[model samples]
Target: MSSVETVKNSPWQQGARDALPLLGGYIPVAISFGLIAVQSGFSALETVLISALIYAGASQFLFIAMVASGAPLWLVLVMTLLINARHLVYGPNIAPYLSNSRWWPVLMHGLTDQIFALAHTRLPQLEEKDRMGWYISAALIAWLSWIVGTAVGAVAGAEITSRWPLLGEVMPFALPALFLVLLAPRFTSVQWTLTMLVSIVAALVLKLMGMTNSAIPLAALCGVSLFYLLQAKLKAEGEIHG
Candidate 1:
């Protein structure tokens, strides 16, 4: 009915237009992270090595900050692992779609918010091979750009630090903003709106009750199960009305 809808329906289009956002979304965060990594008193090579290997951006930022703050190594690990536990869920969820691709595990190691959300929404229209190819291309390009961003930041971070007292300090909050952006559009439904409200309530209750460690997992469980039950019940009622 519209030009945008027409493009979305085209079979020949590769859907790479959406990929442009990832560069801007990732550059500042990655550069800030690289600068922080270097400034945490780690050698430049050390920062380069770890950022390349441990591309889990959030965990890397947390680890360096905790070390800088003199927090225990074990405490940092536990917190990082907890924060990154969502990746564990993502692994199994995407496994079915990627199971037949060559070296899917390697491709999966590059999965991030942009790649995962884009692929989930865009890939079903394309063939399996193309789906895998599109996702890998998007994710890998984003990763390479991140490394370049970090390099630039490492070189410029000192200037920023002198001016802003650690502009890189804001790097840790970027992933949460990324998460919110990815999921924000999906909140258009009433059920999803309620689920988010419930999850927030549950999280606050758990924190106030001193079950802080359990807050995230419990909130996730309550939200997902409630949404699933509501959907099922609504479907059954629709069937009866029909």
Candidate 2:
């Protein structure tokens, strides 16, 4: 390939480019989040700050909903933390790939679901020296997109939505659509399939029982526990047969 193509395909460029798909999803969802948050009675500044500080996608919406319902601050905090508990698993799983980089701690702040997903698939393909730069490039782009999108929605979301009601209806689906895209490829194994099924059932049960706040974290915990048990059982069976 030509030098131009090589330059275009550099790890940093590739990282930024790879994040483009996530950007497509994040921007609209973030915009929707901003509009919803503002409509829910948050000021523009408050909405932007939430996006900047918390940076949790669906959890931010949940936070707004809980607060609007007059739920206590402590409950909001607990629920938000529970919803984002999966980050604990994400960090450890991604740590090995980033061991050589001193900046991983700072970079860890950018570890959202999409970034983690991208890192898992893309980091292994990059050279060691290139991984940090690649991650930084991708994470930074995604972060900026979210922040910018939020600003746009906060500043003009009311006007925009008034003129285009369909956008208001459709934008909320962007986040879930993005998640489904990320998850679809992982359904290749029975372990993953079973784990997800269990998680879904746990969530549905919790939701039905009026325990929606605990559903996400509890379901995640159930899924992770089941996956480990399956792995252990498989290992034991192999040993016994051997």
Candidate 3:
């Protein structure tokens, strides 16, 4: 192979290293999804299909739960889409690295919070192409694992959950917990920290007011936009002081 080809194909250990902790977190959550699907009236085939195809845990949960509760099809569709609205922010944030990759579609579809956090944290100084490869490999593995694990859980779900009552609750907490862990290093930046706090508080406030997932998109926009303006004000003040 040409040196250029070799260089392009060289493996990034950082991606796999970063993905390990994430792999630990997603295992049970995937299992939980499988169990939930079965209990909620989905067959094993259906569970695997949703996990592999829909591929968004929270949205799938909300979608199936709403449908099982006799929610209108339109409402379920809106909720599913709205719950996943956060993806809009994720794409452009990583676009520079991925747009030039050999596998843009794989990166876009496979990338998840675990892989995103891992790559973003480590790739500040790496070339875009290297970062893209690192992130895509890890994210794709994670996505495939989730589907595979869900399929396993679907097969043994009744036995598994019966022995572990907490499975239902613990599995769902995985993603949120993983996010908190990922956010730890970013606390050094006051502006970003404040922005995250504002977004969280806004989401919770909206939830308290009985806003469904549909309204969360707007709440997040308002909160993040407000933080951006506030940060600008602070930067202007700092410049004047300087």
Candidate 4:
């Protein structure tokens, strides 16, 4: 067989290589999560466990904030579920592309926002049978990188924070900065622009109303719904005019 075929058949090798670009982004944020968690009073073990179990950078930061502040369990539960609700949207979109392997469920564990973005954008280029293997390989690499980065940060975070308090203060901003970087590309579209405006307003309002943790999900839900509504309205208007 050809070299491309040989490499493609070994999904793990292909995926690991594909996943490298994402590391420039993922490693720093994962490390920041670990650093922030420990500085926020989490034990290194607890911090590592949070990354291992939660596996979501934004939600993990939110969880650390809530737990450090001693927020109510009910509030934390509500916030966590709401914040992760976007995954519900992600799963259905990806389901059709995935193979019917029994390991599908396990593979799905690696479905993060970034991975999903990568999958939808990149997977279409691959042969159908090879897509799942590549996706699973990419996912596993990303997941492992996150865990390792978290472990590194957890072990060294507290000491680093103590040595350079400014760095600790800066750790919390890393996730938000990363998100802004991700969102920048989408800002060119009118639909995305409107959605961002509405989301920003909603988040600010929620924060003012003392529902800080609830802001992210609520804003996202509002923005997505508004985008769909606007799109439908424009489509209907075009049809009538046509």
Give the Cα lDDT of each candidate: 0.70, 0.81, 0.71, 0.76
TM-score on alpha carbons, each prediction: 0.69, 0.75, 0.75, 0.68
- Model 3 earns a TM-score of 0.75
User: What lDDT tens digits, residue by residue, belong to model 4 across residues 11-50?
Assistant: 6677777666677667767777888887898888888888
Q: Candidate 4: list runs displaced more than 4 Å.
A: 1-10, 158-242
**How do the residues 111-194 of candidate 1 rate in per-residue lDDT, one tens digit apiece?**
774677666655544556566656666777777877877777677866765786544466445545555655666677889998
The residue ranges of model 2 lying beyond 4 angstroms of the native Cα positions read 1-8, 68-70, 165-222, 225-242
Clash counts per candidate, in order, are 0, 0, 0, 0
How would you encode candidate 3's per-residue C-alpha lDDT over 126-163 as one tens digit per residue? 56657766775677678877887798788886687688
RMSD to truth, every model = 5.4, 4.9, 5.8, 5.9
Off by more than 4 A, model 3 = 1-12, 164-177, 201-223, 235-242
Q: If both were scored by lDDT, which would come out higher, candidate 2 or candidate 3?
A: 2
List residue ranges in candidate 1 displaced over 4 A. 1-16, 160-189, 196-219, 229-242
**lDDT top scorer:** 2
Model 1 residue pairs with clashes: none
RMSD of 3: 5.8
